[model samples]
Target: MAKTFEVNKTIKEINERIKNGKAVVVNAEEMVEIVRSKGKVEAAKEIDVVTTGTFSPMCSSGMLFNIGQEPPTMKTSQVWLNNVPCYAGIAAADAYIGATEPAEDDPLNKVYPGRFAYGGGHVIEDLIAGKTVRLKAKAYGTDCYPRKEIEKDITLKDLPNAVMLNPRNCYQNYNCAVNMTSRTIYTYMGPLKANQRNANFATAGQLSPLFNDPYLKTIGLGTRIFLAGSKGYVIGAGTQHVKNPARNERGIPLGGSGTLMIKGDLEGMDPRYFRGLSFQGYGCTASVGIGIPIPILNEEMAWYTGVSDADIQMPVKDYGYDYPNGIGRALAHVTFEELKSGEITVNGKVIPTVPLTSHVISLEIADKLKSWIQKGDFLLTEPVEEIEST
Candidate 1:
């Protein structure tokens, strides 16, 4: 019959044996490893018998015991057999140390520079206080698309047809300006000036405040203005100057009476304005001049189209057009030096060593770095400890 044992009694016996540095062994399962030497009759110390086993009754029973290697210290609470090393206690201590110690190289510890955004625009009008002055104007063109989308996959063949077709499309041109002093909306109209033949069409130099008129503000001195509206067409930013062709009524030169009146439209034009008329079109047209010739300005208008003031403000800068020139120039210099040293990379490739400028690093890259810092990723570590020379 098989013998039965009480579980509690067996556990108690085992614990008692462990306290006394004794262990019980059951039936031997199998042999592990063995080594033999040629000579017999020699001293056991010189006999050289090697064996692999979990535990050995004597040092000579295991090859590792006679290998002339010092045994690792085994603490009372630690356990090992023969000359083999056990790492359970050491690993447990290491885990405890790791849990209590702070990291030295966490990536979430860096500080980043501060940044901001700003924007502004202007509205031309003819009324002052509450007087209705005769406001005569003609809107000649409109645009309602972003330049990037317009330029993408575009060919010369698409140019003519892609031009905004509706000359009277209010969707193409309308903007709002805030009187910084009054904090009121100043509505303005856009569309290149179309009818120079209309006697009421004033000279380009004429100053006309759009909403509060009769306050003739000089038009040509590069006065900064702020225009704002829902369609992402706020302005008086980027470039702020209007040009005039020297011509009198009937499109004739003033002194030379017989000079032929130019019957053709001016090469570059200003969008026309209409009073008390709210027209429908893409908010894009409202934010940009329909006839601005400079492609950069046009591109700016298109890029900002359909963007909201709140959305725009959410970016690093409230107004991209308002970047500080000096800071930008300095950053460009630093970036250039870094590129020369192969410190910065783009598209997984090193940028060629060239003149450095803020433009070179790109606003996207700068913004990304700022974002990483904000999220506690790229951080500076504590200074490393120095080793003493022997």
Candidate 2:
């Protein structure tokens, strides 16, 4: 007769023995049976691996001893296995598993707005007598793209304020002019047009207006102007209305030529700004012209061109240079003694006629006038205000 043992008592004794030994050893046959049974139980408990079983403790008892006999399969095997918490099991059972999803308020998705970061060498320093600086022109983003080709009868007011190109004549002949209005030097595309109604005439589609009308006020003096395919020039005067247009030979029109017209303080052109392809082109050209050997763009150069807030102090005395009405006349007539004797130095410098810096121009007026000006075709008329003298 087969040995009859109490099931609960046998299991309890075996468990006690194993615990005392700190390890369990069974006869080869019994060991195989144990391993096979253990595997089935583990596989069933593993939600991802076992799909055809219900792992109830009662069902597990029959499976534990019937290792060799045909194993019984659970009725709701597929359903129960599929519903098991696999993710939770992995996280609880494995030490290596990590949280996969990111937090809802992650800063990685945030975006920053675009801005111009001015650095060292962005201004025109002293224009040594014979040194040459290459100026390259490139368009950034959709807002800066030059849409229209060169057009005839287009005046400075009719061009896109941001879309600037070298004047055909100016680049060809290297002749430049001082923009009296901005206090920056500008190289003329050619000789001033004798019969042209506007003093400054951009080749049919080559001209662009100042970036902003109000900002034009702060350009101040000693600015530089660079003509693409030519050398950089200094600003003798800022932007001004001339009686005639600067002229050059009517060479090929500069439209679609991918050239640039640069207007700023040459000192602002620190080597840092020349990092990419556009800057490299300018650096190459500048090297060819002036022999000032330097990389197209470097971090050191960028740091040099950036201006600090502390550097921008207001002048004590007002020179009528920035005013539209009598400032010009007032600027011209200030006696040397009066200027010298004044408490501040603002009244001493002669103000050239130029468009105000974009920052200084009124936004309302600029918005209304920009479209017409950028087209380089619209004529602007200032409304006269009737005033009663007090």
Candidate 3:
């Protein structure tokens, strides 16, 4: 039998608990240390909230803009900015460029594995900073709209339509992509040494979303989050969402679970937190930073947030592209704590691990988000809809 803890206390009670110092609040990293020292039961009894976070390379990230509404407005077709093509078939002056879309001169790993030196994300960054971005487009000149082509340097300040929308982001959990071939493989996780010489893990250790809400109890629509150094929200479910994966007794999903459709203003984003990366032989992507806070609605939520790195696990998924001669297998399971130590055993061979994103930076974002909550600048809100699985 388990103790029944209710999170639906009156709003006054929650406020009083905060004022009287009855609630416990800690970042995900700190909560892990505390839980390890005192155990989950004691940690749940004392902790009120935990802030978890990570820097994700969400290639789906991009921006939609309505360029200048010059006279003879025709649908913005054949659009390019800073040498990268933007999808402009939607309407006149409206266009979108995916974060990983490469420059025209170097397409599809032609010039580089990812051609990440510059791309759509860079164009957005420059626009937000008021730096001029070269824009070119060709349109059919019609009687009502007679603009054939428009070429000029424009800033986002003058753009009529501007929205930063990502269809999939902040994956609740994800696979640790592994390469098994003899040849070295370059991917979003950097280059994978051959013969399983190295492993790469993303997700910030201890401070990750799924670990904080292993059961998807608190994260849902309208949940405020830190996205690329700016405030963003989970609008709905993300792409490829799947639920009900195998799990241990703790009930943490064994595979990637709920995802998020997030939105935010690019103007306030930090450039360092939003980066474009490439692999020697792979395509490019945007490394987007994200952070979410889990409210201790019940003792269960507290227990979930206190889960340690040793308990957080991920399966090594074989991409198989790197190892054509070798048969791909499910591989082995490894813990975040084990992954953080820089090496893990795979097929009886010890290999080094590299993190695609910066843990140091991830923790910093969590701390900043927590401070905002404490200072009354940020507020926690319940999701309009709860996310159950994929």
Per-residue lDDT, model 3, residue 292, is 91
Tens digit of per-residue lDDT, candidate 2, span 1-390: 854322212223323433454212211112223324544233222111000000000000000000011112111101100011111221111111011111122232223111111111111111112133221111121333222121122221221221111121111111111223423211212112121111221111111112111112211222222222122332222222121222212221111111212232222233221211101101101111110000102221111112111211121111212322333221122221222222222224333221111111122222222222233222221212211111
**Higher TM-score: candidate 2 or 3?**
3
Error of 2 at 132 (Å): 25
Indicate the worst ten consecutive residues by lDDT in candidate 3: 6-15
Mind sharing the TM-score for model 1? 0.12
lDDT for each residue of candidate 1 in 1-390, tens digit (9 for 90 to 100): 943322112223433433453422110010000001211122111211111001000000000011111122112222121111212232211100110111222222222111101000011111111222221111121242112110012121211211111111111111111111222111121111121100010111100011001111111112211111001111121121111222222221211011000011111112221111211110101112111100001111111211111111000110112222222111111121232243333324332222111221222222332233234332211112211111
Shift of residue 382 alpha carbon in model 2, Å = 40
Positional deviation of residue 370's Cα in model 2 after best superposition, in angstroms: 41
Model 3 score (lDDT): 0.74
lDDT at 299, model 1: 18
Relative to the true structure, how large is the alpha-carbon lDDT of every model? Answer: 0.17, 0.19, 0.74
TM-score, candidate number 2? 0.15
Candidate 2: misplaced stretches above 4 Å?
A: 1-230, 233-327, 331-390
Off by over 4 Å in 3: 1-3, 6-24, 36-46, 107-116, 321-329
Who wins the lDDT comparison?
3
